[model samples]
Target: MDESNNNIKEPEKRAFLKGAGLSIAALLVGGLSIERYAVPKDRSVPVMDNFPLAILEDPSGQPVTTSEVIEFAGAKTTTTSSPILVFNYPLQDEPTFLIALKGVKITTPNTPPSSGFAPVPSGTDAPMDGIIYDSTTNTSILAVSGICQHLGCVPPFLDYHPGQSVPFESELIGYKLNGAGVKKWPDYGLIYCKCHGSQYNPVWGGRNLYNNGPAASPAKHSLPQIMLATDSNGYIYAYGINSSNAVIRTHLNFPGGETYGSGVKSEDLTGGTAIRQSTRSLPANLSLYKNTTLESVAPSSLGTNQSSGAIILYKTTVVSNENKNGLNWKGTF
Candidate 1:
């Protein structure tokens, strides 16, 4: 976790408050709506004109580079064994959960056929379902999509403890029930949806037991795994994701089920059914995008707070017109 930078130190911490809402139009170079953007006068980098791109003179725009390493304790601040840590970037839309699993048993750090682990959803034989490491403390980080598939609810990162109601317990973890009406879990690795009790396993990375919930298909709902990269200096960078094109504008879609879709705040209902959900590890997802698309970028320095990595937003599209700050593309539960 080296904080020493080869480059010169930037100015003091800067605050750039990004609008949490996404308009129908993306960030175009000129106006709010991009339908009538001016064509570039110059002929060089023609495709670069396609995106309304912005670059920082310094890391002035980065949000997570501070020295604020969110510690293990939560609202209580007492010692506890909560399974995961959630870093919420309210400014970013769609699938907004940055989860770090606290004590997941890792038989291997490199790849799988992982011992003491279940099968994580992947397209190939070698499944590197998402798992990162704080090698310093041996903690595994799971920066999973918070948007639930059965419905879009930001499930809590909670410890599983019986005989304790969710509200009375200050453990920062939850004890939500599954489809089978079971609330007592044998482990603490569940990202339990409060809306409809859609339970997803971060331990196995992108594992969904639809039989455990009321998802239409067998294991249809899966948490979207985020892509992350880290320099030897302990900087974890999130650049991409493998998620469903499914749009969930409201969480009321599947009410009364193991999970329900209800409007998080004032989000309008957008139309798109989830095809499937699966979790792929950061390394695996990165490889999939790279191998298939063969994209590359020259190296450049990004200013970061060093506490967390600012999300590297590669793409975003407005899906619903319900509110001024409409929802962006989201994953199925």
Candidate 2:
């Protein structure tokens, strides 16, 4: 009886061990499934969508023609200033910089050098054709997001530095005329950010033009270029954003969970109330301060439905730049 009992107990122990092993294996498989489906893959490509085409409008609510942009840019350039026109597209709250590169024909093969950070979405590594409208002269008109990629800073802080005219911040940060300094600055003016000194070369598809300075660019991506088209009537229209890998600043163009929506980036257009027309043009020579205010004016005042605002311009008074310590400055209205 004892021998029989031992034999039965041995078999029972083997069967129990086998069942436990199978249960553990099942749990391991289940855990893997959850992990695979729950968490998104890192650096997953953003879902690309074509935003609705918007007509480019002036402050007067009229269709802005290419010829007009060129003419305005020429007028500004004659005074050693660059035109920085602000308009909203694809979304009401998102402002874009509509600029014309005077005496420079922006052509194809303007692909920016890879920074080796963000994964370049397929088919976007090339130049965006038909976006740059040839003005029948050296001028070429294009548009880009006004928001800085380093931080979400807007106009006046991220305005263009035209030709040889360097911003005080740009000068301190080592940008020089004709690329004369240790770090070469482009001959054409860059889109400079005074907030943190980040710079973008608009000629090179708004690529980040990093400089050697204490306040180097903290941004990793280039400015998203706005796609443009022109009708036979010479009217320019903003159709969509360039389907490039460079994501728009502050638009939540990241991977993983859906903030805007699952795999829907164009839905970002839904949140902000659309700006009806361009804001008043600010001159490049005016001294800009962090405390400068935008006083809103009634739509009726502008003779349009667009709510307009004016930036109070100031002149800079530099006290000293002794010892190359940076400019000691004050603003006077």
Candidate 3:
């Protein structure tokens, strides 16, 4: 995406030489107090060990500057419900698409995640243009690959109801690993691939086969989550993609073969080094990756009557992120 980092005049690149110290595929449990009580499952984000200083590069392989906000604002021509738009990023193959899920409700916690980006949904309608700075529900824009995870086929966005739109193979029946890396089935209506009926979460991490697809396939069941970053001026950047339970299907000829069982563990096909499982992740962790830098922005209302921190008023889809204790921490490192 050819975005201009014009909104916020940044000072300079804030780089760290050392750990400054501490960090995702699923939280590095070596440290950090793992709360034993029944906390909100989304809060159990993976705290990586490495710093989030990764360089964010666009598809052209150019270093993404803070001014990239210009492009993000330009991409949204109109605020259509669940509009599927593209942000040319990573350039690994193609630009990532930021699909807007109009009505699906997700959980939004009271406080911002210490990491910044968490699976919190503002539960508000997405702006036609520009990123919605939501400190509350946290998720408003979900960036993902337009390609289907089944066989890299480009899929169509369908209406959830049958007959009016394309019919699904059946009621979505599938399961995926949650933040805790536990497998369970979840239903994210409407956003399903017409190509193979592979349903996924239109928001958050863009899970693959949250309902099982095909007779039986293998892998961590994840679609690539386009890593999203926002600037101080309410700009959303598609810098990279995130994938999990990485595996390479080399020999489909021998699906049951012993050698085929232990396929290759490939690194992410994204341009950015840092990875986040879902929006519930601490956005700050992304800054720890090298090559890129992110300065957290407070929630800013888009071009709406509602004011800052008042997103709840204009909310159409409210994703609740309630903590077990029901307290709002300052939510910072």
lDDT of each candidate versus the true structure: 0.30, 0.45, 0.29
User: In candidate 1, where is summed lDDT lowest over 10 consecutive residues?
Assistant: 49-58
Give the residue spans of candidate 1 off by over 4 A: 1-70, 73-91, 105-130, 155-183, 209-219, 243-333
Please write out the lDDT profile of model 3 over residues 104-137, one tens digit for every residue: 2333223323331233355453321122223333
Q: Which residue pairs overlap in candidate 2's backbone?
A: 92-274
Tens-digit lDDT string for candidate 2 (35-137): 1221123213321122434456543345666766665665543221254566654443345677777655444344555442221223323223434535346
Q: Which sections of candidate 3 miss by over 4 Å?
A: 1-80, 92-95, 102-139, 155-188, 212-220, 243-333
Instruction: Score candidate 2 by TM-score against the native.
Output: 0.56
Best by lDDT: 2
Candidate 2 CA-lDDT value:
0.45
* CA displacement after TM-score superposition, residue 86 of candidate 1 (Å): 4.9
Candidate 3 local Cα displacement, residue 235, angstroms:
1.7
| Backbone clash count for every predicted candidate, in the order shown | 22, 1, 49
Error of 2 at 37 (Å): 33
CA lDDT for candidate 1? 0.30
Compose the digit string of candidate 1's lDDT tens values, residues 1-333.
111211213222111111211111222222242211211122121111011111101122232310122242222222122322233221122334444434342222233222232423232223233344443443444455555554243433222221222432222233343334533333434455433345555555534322332232212456645544443333444433332212222222223323312222212112211111112122212211222232323212222122234212221211111111121212212
lDDT of 3: 0.29
